[model samples]
Target: MKALIVYASVHHQNTEKVAKVMAEELGADLVPIGQAQPSTLTAYDLIGFGSGVYGKKFHKTLIQFVEALPAVTGKRAFIFSTSGGGEIQTHAAPKKLLMNRGFSIVGDFSCKGWTTWGPLKLFGGTNKGRPNEEDLEEARVFARGLKEKYI
Candidate 1:
């Protein structure tokens, strides 16, 4: 199935790294959330929204983008995020938003990322050198599995 991975990876480009691997594995379109238009979402059978977690949420721009999208009932979708904590709950806000729009939540992924922003910067960073080879491979595997399950 056709898929698009729209993401916003700032700080260390951690989430962007994951998005690229997923895009390669799924043969999907890759675009920054800033470049994505809500009107074009229907072209893909599957949509992936990803971001570096900021204060326990996906990037604001992505959330806003999804909110602006026209009613996309029953669309297939996945969520991914990069964070110092790498908590699954970080995906909650966006997941809820998508579900409210009637998108099916097929799967979600999260991985620790090097984060040195704010107070964490005082400790150098967390998950240094993360989204490393192993992490990317896991993401690749995850994408392949999603393809198997949904496509």
Candidate 2:
């Protein structure tokens, strides 16, 4: 029941915060998407992908990485995202993408985060101080459940 969390949280570390909380709860390895190697994907039983939503999707690089990932059928995976103004549906892209590649969509999670990037930055961002402590605790609780159910 090994687990790994690979994430890309560029702006303000919003997504990273959620990933870390979940990782600690699940006792999973945490790796930045930029530094993750293909071999890293093979080591885990349950792999979780996390990212901050950009225009209703996970980071382009994260999607590309999964697209290029070596074939492995029936592998379990979960998707999580931090967003300024979106919901769990924004996680659908990653879920669909992974499902297309033979990874089982075991679970998913989402939460709002303080985002001040792109055009939203000019307007002083949204969800200030979000993905806050309460939100992170929710993430931890969710991770615990995923561990019990999926791992």
TM-scores vs. true structure, each candidate: 0.95, 0.92
Model 1 TM: 0.95
Q: Could you report the Cα RMSD, in angstroms, for every candidate shown?
A: 1.2, 1.6
lDDT of 2 by residue, 1-151 (tens): 8999999988889999999999999999999999998788887889999999887778988988888888787689989999887489877777877888788988888889998877878878889899999999999999999989877
RMSD of 2: 1.6
The C-alpha stretches of model 2 lying farther than 4 A from their native spots are: 118-123
lDDT of 1 by residue, 1-57 (tens): 689999999779999999999999898999998899997798888999999988887
Q: Which residue runs does candidate 1 get wrong by more than 4 Å?
A: none
Error of 2 at 90 (Å): 1.9
lDDT value, residue 34 of candidate 1: 82
